[model samples]
Target: MRPGIHPASRPVVFRDRAAGTLFLIPSTATASKTIEWEDGNTYPLIDVEISSASHPFSTGTARVVDAAGRIERFERRYGRRPAPSRG
Candidate 1:
Protein backbone atom coordinates (compact mmCIF):
# COMPACT_ATOMS: atom_id res chain seq x y z
CA MET A 1 0.00 0.00 0.00
CA ARG A 2 1.38 3.39 -0.98
CA PRO A 3 1.39 6.43 1.29
CA GLY A 4 -1.65 8.05 -0.38
CA ILE A 5 -2.89 5.75 -3.12
CA HIS A 6 -5.28 3.47 -1.31
CA PRO A 7 -8.99 4.27 -1.59
CA ALA A 8 -10.68 5.09 1.67
CA SER A 9 -14.12 3.77 2.63
CA ARG A 10 -16.14 6.57 4.14
CA PRO A 11 -19.83 7.17 4.75
CA VAL A 12 -21.90 8.86 2.02
CA VAL A 13 -25.46 9.95 1.44
CA PHE A 14 -27.63 9.73 -1.68
CA ARG A 15 -30.82 11.72 -2.11
CA ASP A 16 -33.47 12.11 -4.80
CA ARG A 17 -34.90 15.56 -5.02
CA ALA A 18 -37.95 14.56 -6.99
CA ALA A 19 -39.13 11.63 -4.93
CA GLY A 20 -37.79 13.09 -1.69
CA THR A 21 -35.86 10.02 -0.59
CA LEU A 22 -32.75 10.01 1.53
CA PHE A 23 -30.14 7.30 2.11
CA LEU A 24 -26.79 7.06 3.84
CA ILE A 25 -24.08 4.85 2.45
CA PRO A 26 -20.32 4.37 2.73
CA SER A 27 -18.88 6.52 0.01
CA THR A 28 -19.69 10.27 -0.18
CA ALA A 29 -22.59 11.81 1.66
CA THR A 30 -22.96 14.91 -0.51
CA ALA A 31 -26.67 15.04 -1.08
CA SER A 32 -28.65 16.61 1.78
CA LYS A 33 -29.74 16.05 5.36
CA THR A 34 -28.01 13.45 7.64
CA ILE A 35 -28.61 9.96 8.95
CA GLU A 36 -27.07 7.43 11.33
CA TRP A 37 -26.97 4.00 9.74
CA GLU A 38 -27.26 0.65 11.51
CA ASP A 39 -23.52 0.01 11.42
CA GLY A 40 -22.98 2.33 14.35
CA ASN A 41 -22.01 4.98 11.86
CA THR A 42 -23.49 8.27 10.67
CA TYR A 43 -23.53 9.92 7.27
CA PRO A 44 -25.22 12.82 5.53
CA LEU A 45 -28.80 12.17 4.54
CA ILE A 46 -29.54 12.88 0.86
CA ASP A 47 -33.09 13.16 -0.48
CA VAL A 48 -33.50 11.19 -3.70
CA GLU A 49 -36.28 9.20 -5.36
CA ILE A 50 -35.00 7.22 -8.34
CA SER A 51 -31.59 6.14 -7.18
CA SER A 52 -30.42 2.60 -7.85
CA ALA A 53 -31.87 1.84 -4.42
CA SER A 54 -35.42 2.55 -5.62
CA HIS A 55 -35.03 2.68 -9.42
CA PRO A 56 -36.58 0.24 -11.81
CA PHE A 57 -33.27 -1.29 -12.89
CA SER A 58 -32.41 -2.29 -9.33
CA THR A 59 -35.77 -2.68 -7.60
CA GLY A 60 -37.82 -3.85 -10.57
CA THR A 61 -40.06 -0.80 -10.51
CA ALA A 62 -41.73 0.02 -13.83
CA ARG A 63 -40.78 3.12 -15.78
CA VAL A 64 -43.61 5.41 -16.82
CA VAL A 65 -43.03 6.95 -20.22
CA ASP A 66 -44.78 10.19 -21.06
CA ALA A 67 -46.75 9.32 -24.18
CA ALA A 68 -48.88 12.42 -24.10
CA GLY A 69 -46.16 14.16 -26.05
CA ARG A 70 -46.86 13.92 -29.79
CA ILE A 71 -43.24 13.39 -30.69
CA GLU A 72 -43.86 12.19 -34.21
CA ARG A 73 -46.40 14.88 -34.91
CA PHE A 74 -44.19 17.57 -33.45
CA GLU A 75 -41.20 16.41 -35.43
CA ARG A 76 -43.23 16.20 -38.61
CA ARG A 77 -44.23 19.84 -38.24
CA TYR A 78 -40.95 21.49 -37.14
CA GLY A 79 -38.10 19.46 -35.70
CA ARG A 80 -35.48 19.35 -38.43
CA ARG A 81 -32.66 21.59 -39.52
CA PRO A 82 -30.78 21.61 -42.81
CA ALA A 83 -27.61 19.57 -42.25
CA PRO A 84 -24.43 21.42 -43.20
CA SER A 85 -22.77 18.54 -44.97
CA ARG A 86 -19.13 18.28 -45.99
CA GLY A 87 -18.40 18.24 -49.71
Candidate 2:
Protein backbone atom coordinates (compact mmCIF):
# COMPACT_ATOMS: atom_id res chain seq x y z
CA MET A 1 0.00 0.00 0.00
CA ARG A 2 3.05 2.26 -0.19
CA PRO A 3 2.96 4.99 -2.82
CA GLY A 4 5.77 5.44 -5.39
CA ILE A 5 7.53 2.30 -4.10
CA HIS A 6 5.97 -0.43 -6.21
CA PRO A 7 5.50 -0.56 -9.95
CA ALA A 8 2.15 0.74 -11.06
CA SER A 9 -0.23 -1.88 -12.44
CA ARG A 10 -2.27 -0.98 -15.49
CA PRO A 11 -4.45 -2.84 -17.91
CA VAL A 12 -2.37 -4.97 -20.24
CA VAL A 13 -3.41 -7.21 -23.07
CA PHE A 14 -1.88 -10.66 -22.98
CA ARG A 15 -2.14 -12.40 -26.30
CA ASP A 16 -1.84 -16.17 -26.31
CA ARG A 17 -0.44 -16.80 -29.73
CA ALA A 18 -0.76 -20.56 -29.54
CA ALA A 19 -4.36 -20.42 -28.40
CA GLY A 20 -5.19 -17.42 -30.54
CA THR A 21 -6.78 -15.80 -27.53
CA LEU A 22 -6.55 -12.29 -26.15
CA PHE A 23 -6.83 -11.50 -22.47
CA LEU A 24 -7.09 -8.05 -20.92
CA ILE A 25 -5.95 -7.80 -17.35
CA PRO A 26 -3.93 -5.70 -14.98
CA SER A 27 -0.19 -6.30 -15.10
CA THR A 28 3.17 -4.64 -14.50
CA ALA A 29 4.72 -6.35 -17.55
CA THR A 30 6.08 -4.21 -20.37
CA ALA A 31 5.15 -4.40 -24.00
CA SER A 32 6.15 -2.52 -27.12
CA LYS A 33 2.93 -3.00 -29.06
CA THR A 34 -0.60 -1.91 -28.36
CA ILE A 35 -3.99 -3.06 -29.58
CA GLU A 36 -7.54 -1.77 -29.49
CA TRP A 37 -9.71 -3.95 -27.29
CA GLU A 38 -13.42 -4.70 -27.54
CA ASP A 39 -14.11 -1.86 -25.12
CA GLY A 40 -12.70 0.56 -27.68
CA ASN A 41 -9.57 1.22 -25.65
CA THR A 42 -5.91 0.63 -26.40
CA TYR A 43 -3.84 -1.45 -23.94
CA PRO A 44 -0.27 -2.64 -23.81
CA LEU A 45 0.11 -5.91 -25.68
CA ILE A 46 2.27 -8.76 -24.39
CA ASP A 47 2.45 -11.91 -26.46
CA VAL A 48 2.94 -15.20 -24.58
CA GLU A 49 3.94 -18.58 -25.92
CA ILE A 50 1.72 -20.54 -23.56
CA SER A 51 -1.25 -19.92 -21.32
CA SER A 52 -3.96 -21.84 -19.47
CA ALA A 53 -6.12 -21.71 -22.57
CA SER A 54 -3.62 -23.62 -24.70
CA HIS A 55 -1.59 -25.58 -22.13
CA PRO A 56 -1.67 -29.37 -22.29
CA PHE A 57 -2.87 -29.87 -18.71
CA SER A 58 -5.48 -27.15 -18.94
CA THR A 59 -6.77 -28.46 -22.26
CA GLY A 60 -6.83 -32.07 -20.96
CA THR A 61 -4.31 -33.22 -23.57
CA ALA A 62 -1.39 -33.98 -21.27
CA ARG A 63 0.27 -37.39 -21.55
CA VAL A 64 1.31 -39.32 -18.46
CA VAL A 65 5.09 -39.82 -18.26
CA ASP A 66 6.50 -43.35 -17.87
CA ALA A 67 8.22 -42.62 -14.56
CA ALA A 68 8.62 -46.23 -13.37
CA GLY A 69 10.22 -47.37 -16.63
CA ARG A 70 12.54 -44.38 -16.63
CA ILE A 71 13.65 -45.09 -13.05
CA GLU A 72 14.37 -48.73 -13.88
CA ARG A 73 16.35 -47.78 -16.95
CA PHE A 74 18.35 -45.18 -15.02
CA GLU A 75 19.14 -47.71 -12.25
CA ARG A 76 20.27 -50.26 -14.82
CA ARG A 77 22.54 -47.76 -16.53
CA TYR A 78 24.01 -46.18 -13.35
CA GLY A 79 23.81 -49.25 -11.04
CA ARG A 80 21.37 -49.34 -8.16
CA ARG A 81 22.47 -48.28 -4.72
CA PRO A 82 23.29 -51.00 -2.21
CA ALA A 83 20.80 -51.63 0.56
CA PRO A 84 21.71 -49.96 3.89
CA SER A 85 22.85 -52.33 6.67
CA ARG A 86 20.78 -52.43 9.86
CA GLY A 87 22.77 -50.95 12.78
Whole-model Cα lDDT of every candidate shown, in order: 0.66, 0.96
Candidate 2: deviation at residue 7, Å? 0.8
What RMSD, rounded to one decimal, does every model reach?
Answer: 6.6, 4.0
| Model 1 ranges with Cα > 4 A deviation | 1-3, 28-42, 45-49, 63-87
lDDT of 2 by residue, 1-87 (tens): 878899989999999999999999999999999999999999999999999999999999999999999999999999999999999
Compute each candidate's TM-score over C-alphas: 0.38, 0.74
Instruction: Show the lowest summed lDDT stretch of 10 residues, model 1.
Output: 23-32
Using lDDT, give the best candidate's number.
2
Candidate 1 lDDT tens digits, 14-60: 76765566556577335455667678667767565577656676776
